[model samples]
Each structure stands twice: as structure tokens, then as C-alpha cells.
Target: MAKHNIYKMSVSEVYPHYITKAEKKGRTKEEVDEIIIWLTGYTQAQLDKELEKKTDFETFFVNAPNMNPARTLIKGVICGIRVEDIEEPIMKEIRYLDKLVDELAKGKSMDKILRK
Candidate 1:
């Protein structure tokens, strides 16, 4: 009999990719994704649910302010989310984005980090 490919496995099973070339450090693929959710400021349960559609901050900020994944978690974990309270993180992200704009505007050796 032959073994099954990870890509063919369910989300509960194979994840993050079927190959690894480096030291293979860090947590399980699922855990890594959960942490990414936390770092992006999602609540634990919200992070765990894999059913909801995925979204990014840029789209939420531009088109659907009501559809922010982080906002969902933030409202759940913290006090009621106020426009004033969110101003800082939003500004920070905007500044970070603007820095990328500035760097690219200068035509530097844009690496993978900046590309994202």
C-alpha cells in the first residue's frame, strides 16, 4: 500500500505544507496558525474556528470596516472597541505600510519581507 500525501489530508491532519528544508523548528502547523491569529490580535476561540471566511486588515480598513477579523477578537478580548482606542494600532500599521511605500519609492533591493 502507498502512503497518503499531506495535501490530501484534512485541515486537522496535514498542514503548513508537506515539505521542510530548514531546521524544522517551532510549534505544530496548527499552533503556528493560531499564534498568527493571536499576533494579528484574534481571540483564542475566534482563532480556533476554521469555518469563517478569511480577511485581511487592508480590505477591512478600505471596504468593510465591519468585517475585521482582528476587530472581532479585539472586541471579544478587550473592552468595547472604540474608534479612538483603535486609532493607535491603525496608525501604526499605516505608518508601517507607508514606510514600505517610501522604501519601494526609493527603488531599494526590495526583499521578500518588504514584498509582503
Candidate 2:
């Protein structure tokens, strides 16, 4: 797998890819946004504002209003690396998002995906 500078990557740029992945698998962008909101505790409006401003991942996470407490329960392999074992905090958070998107693409139910 290719390693890219995730911290420097734009959240806005990556978000569309998540929407496309979900949509291709019969999911909706609204569902994708809902998952994002669940993870970051950002309102849809706040997420929209961040996307409009084109913030980088570093900025996006740092400025998140209320990252969910249950996010720590998100565990699994993403890109062959176990998310729970990730040493870097930022990488772990990114992987959590990746896992959520993967679940959505795999047609997992919203309640289950959100760890409800």
C-alpha cells in the first residue's frame, strides 16, 4: 500500500470519495454524512462549513466540536493494519473513519455501524 501524508491531505477532498464509495454500494451521501456526524459530533452544518473551507485532516480533527466517546470501540484492520494497535492518535482516528466507511459500503446497518 502507498503511504501518503494524511495529515496534510484535505478532509474536503477525501470526503467526496467516501460519499462515492457509499453511493456506489447503494448508500446515500446523507448516510455518509450521518456517519461522519456520529464520529465527530459535528452537525451537518458544521461539516458543510469545514468542507467549504477545505480544511486539512489536522485542522479538521483538531477543530471538531465533540468527537464521540464511543469511537474508541472502533477496532479492526484497515489497509491491513489493526486500528486498535495504531500508535499514532491521528492515524487511529483516520482508521476509525475508514472502518466506518467500509462498513457502510459493505451494507452494514446504521445502528450497528455506529456501534449503538
Best by TM-score: 2
Q: Which stretches of candidate 2 lie over 4 Å from their true place?
A: 1-4
CA error at residue 44 for candidate 1, angstroms? 27
- Estimate the Cα RMSD of every predicted model relative to the unseen true structure: 16.2, 2.5
> What would the per-residue lDDT of candidate 2 be over residues 1-116, giving only the tens digit for each residue?
44449988989999989999999999999999998899998999999999999888877887888999999988889999998999877778888999999999999999999999
Q: What is the C-alpha lDDT of each candidate?
A: 0.33, 0.90
lDDT at 61, model 2: 83
For model 1, residues 1-116, the per-residue Cα lDDT tens digits are 34223213333231233112111532243434432333344454553443233433343223321322432222211223333344454433333333333333334433421332
Worst 10 residues of 1 by lDDT: 14-23
Off by over 4 Å in 1: 1-87, 112-116
